[model samples]
Target: MTAPPAFPAPHPSPLDLGGRTALVTGAAGGIGRACALRLADAGAKVRAVDRDAGGLEALAEEAHGLAGAVEPHVLDLTDLDAAELAAVGTDVLVNNAGLQLVRPIEEFPPDAFHTVLTVMLEAPFRLIRGALPHMYGQGWGRIVNVSSVHGLRASAYKSAYVAAKHGLEGLSKTAALEGAPHGVTSNCVNPAYVRTPLVERQIADQARTHGIPEERVLSEVLLQDSAVKRLIEPEEVAEAVAYLCGPQASFVTGTSLVLDGGWTAH
Candidate 1:
């Protein structure tokens, strides 16, 4: 409801983050893991947060030789207070953690819907709140929300995911307006279907819901609307996040960078 006192300065290099601190949620796997690695590659001190301690450990191991370092912080985003606390002092924040459940509105479980919204929408809000002060003080920050095509367009049986992403898109734009005066840019990267463990796991759920074979879910359901006809890679989505964090995108804010492989074009 209230805004922070803000303006950030400038960095010359597009991908250099020599002394920056970045907090990436859902960093244990999927888009989160890729983003952590990408930010660290740019010399950021990355605080990788996720409930998966094992995955975070493996991520740390994989980031051993990067230009920056990955500090694994195991925390479930459902703990709103802790999620906010964990975001303190971050220069950049990537809100990418999410879960999906496929079912008709009549059949959808309320608990699952609540969990999805809490993690995807509520946690991001807390993280942003925690990070704003430091960003405002320093006069420069980037907030990248890894949204989805569903943020702009809806599909059947993905009510929770759609609602959460749409809410995130609005939140991102509002942050952009409020934080712009303080040298912070907020934006959403709307990727279509992505190749990740989460998406892979959803294949079966989707198949069951659609009464289709698991093998056909990808071609018939997920990619049906995408002109690209393929699932986006996690690294590709991370690159978009990196760009938004870079010098080139300093002027780019309050926007949804749609990378839906022409899905929206149609």
Candidate 2:
């Protein structure tokens, strides 16, 4: 076989998205909030979408003085049509909204499973469907799905979350293939357990599921498989999302940018 093409030299200028519009779901807080701010810092007009009106307000306030503005758009991704509509006229899309329930499959609530799948998997598809028109029209777009280690590897008590993320991984790749010719790229940022409100909320559920105290849950459960033995910061994962949207990643599509603290190394 012929040798692969040589990698190009790094660009000198920093990432600059002066007039682009970006929509980040779950922008109320955590990885999504960090992503909204990071993209705004790169001069992208960020539409921060989430169900938490107050949290979105706080995020908007925090993003003041950035290179670009953060416009809070209160949205519930489970509203599929609204989710798609909210993504209209956008350049970049970050699918990060999610819910988790730690319970055995036999004990899992069917409604909760459906909700997790809807928020984590189906909503991303709708958002992509909405964003594609504008992105295809402009001949450029970035779709970053904030997945997790659970997307790649399963855990005992997180059937719904694991299944949803795995499905997200597949959806991301499919988008990449279909959008490649249109100059749009789709990729997943698979981070390990992150230090966010979501994780904090899950601590109790995990504790109950694993029969461990809340205090021991972090070390014995969440970080057990991670070589780093610590939760990843939301900003760290956000930086990965920013990188995927930068010029450096124009050809980097249909891939998992795993930031799993070596959880998948095994």
Candidate 3:
């Protein structure tokens, strides 16, 4: 077999992914949507997968006229076998589908906890398992896990979310070690309070749980630990994902690219 062509100077800069195919879970909205669009902008054919069929349609509509195509794939990550099948043959994988239930340990439902781990942790493993053979065959691939600051630090009323993300971090690292020789890189992007439907939905829950008004949740709860004093944009996190999938990050593996705005500094 012939060797791959040499990457252009300033590799992955100018971030061209033309002819590549990327699969992004939870691609209906928020950071997932942003990542799908960003990858498509970089000329990658994107498989936008989500449980929300309408949202997927909207995402595909918005992706019109991009450098590459957006193919809508309606999938519920809870379906482990289907999730794995959805990932096959992709050159890039962004594991971003997640769910959150903010309640103290005692109040957290057992089923909810299981669902969190299944969607956030186990599904990623299966997706990676599904994507690996094709990636290994070509001797190149990228896996970017959308972890959270919770992955590294504990947070109140977030037992399930925290546990799942922490597990994802470990999974990402293990994949990195195994994928190294095959030219595949696995990494996590840790963000704090991204401005997405997930975070917006949490505001009211946080207010009620913390005995504060919804308006104050942003300052007193969400951004309190972040030195930047603001919510991060979905697009910003997507950019980091793109960078990881780029040629410049080939040597970057088994690590978390944190975009927490100093949340972990405390």
TM accuracy, model 1: 0.94
Clashes of 2: 0
Q: Tell me the whole-model lDDT of each prediction, alpha carbons only.
A: 0.92, 0.89, 0.91
Of the candidates numbered 1 and 2, which has the greater lDDT value? 1
Give me the runs in candidate 3 sitting further than 4 Å from their true place. 1-13
TM-score of 2: 0.94
Q: Candidate 3 deviates by what RMSD?
A: 8.0
Per-residue CA lDDT of model 2 for 1-266, tens digit only, reads 11123223223236798999999999998899988988898899999999999999999999999999999999888899999999999999999998888889999999999999999999999999999999999899999999988889999988999999999999999999999999999999999987788988988888888887888888788878888766777878888898999989999999999998889988
Query: Which candidate leads in lDDT?
Result: 1
For model 1, state the Cα shift of residue 46 in Å: 0.4
Summarize candidate 1's per-residue lDDT along 1-266 as a digit string, tens digits: 01122113122234898899999999999999999999998999999999999999999999999999999999999999999999999999999999999999999999999999999999999999999999999899999999999999999999999999999999999999999999999999999988788987888889899998888888888889988766777888888999999988999999999989899998
Clashes of 3: 0
Q: All candidates' TM-scores?
A: 0.94, 0.94, 0.94
Deviation of model 1 at 12, angstroms: 17
Runs in model 1 with CA error above 4 Å? 1-14
